[model samples]
Target chain A: MKISARNQIKGTIKSVTKGQTTSHIQLEVNGTIITASITNEAVDDLNLKPGQNAYAVIKASDVMIAVD
Target chain B: MKISARNQIKGTIKSVTKGQTTSHIQLEVNGTIITASITNEAVDDLNLKPGQNAYAVIKASDVMIAVD
Candidate 1:
């Protein structure tokens, strides 16, 4: 599906750790690792597995800038 | 406010472009620019301006991993 999220980092799936209702999908982009927490239902629907290519989709609004 | 978001990237405000309803806040993080789309009210509430130190806060669940 087409999305409006601006950040789409291409990476390879390193691992998938499932919890009760959510899952953490680790993606290795270049040498950096980005962790994505999604619903277990989405994980099953996507059929995501290790060594697969994927993109980390992040919406611009979801990104909040804070001053320390 | 203390949030549960996983990714909190520290950066400097590079620019702020406001539209009718939302504003795009650009942050320079280690030479990379991360854009955040927020409401104009929020911008005013936060008083975010250029050349200020800030952080790009991102929730883990909001990050979606996509496959081709």
Candidate 2:
């Protein structure tokens, strides 16, 4: 599948936490644990599991640097 | 439409630069310029233009904080 985002980091799924309407997905990328909050359907569609290889697609605009 | 990923931020389209296969999208969120590198098709499909309001939908898994 083709996507628009530029940052696609390859990693392995570390954990999946399902909530009522959303789910938190954790992946280990170069020893960095990145968490993703997505919908249950996304989890079901992607069939995300531990040890599975996945790409983290991020749009630069979506990234917000916290300012103090 | 409902999306799965979390970390959605509202902003205005600042500019759109189209390349051969990709495009660079810039957005102003709370006076901060956030950039997004997406596909040219995504830009066309989304009709992203300056002064337009858009949402930066980010999946947490894709977010990686740089550390020293």
lDDT of each candidate versus the true structure: 0.87, 0.78
- Evaluated against the true structure, the overall lDDT of model 1 is 0.87
Off by over 4 Å in 2: A1-68, B66-68
lDDT of 1 at B3: 75
Q: What tens-digit string does per-residue lDDT give for candidate 2 at B3-68?
A: 345567889999999999878889899999989878787888667789988877667566899988
Q: Pick the candidate with the highest DockQ.
A: 1
DockQ of the two-chain complex in candidate 2:
0.17
TM-score for the first chain of model 2? 0.88
Model 2: TM-score for chain B: 0.89
Worst 10 residues of 1 chain A by lDDT: A26-35
Give, for candidate 1 chain B, the lowest lDDT window spanning 10 residues.
B2-11
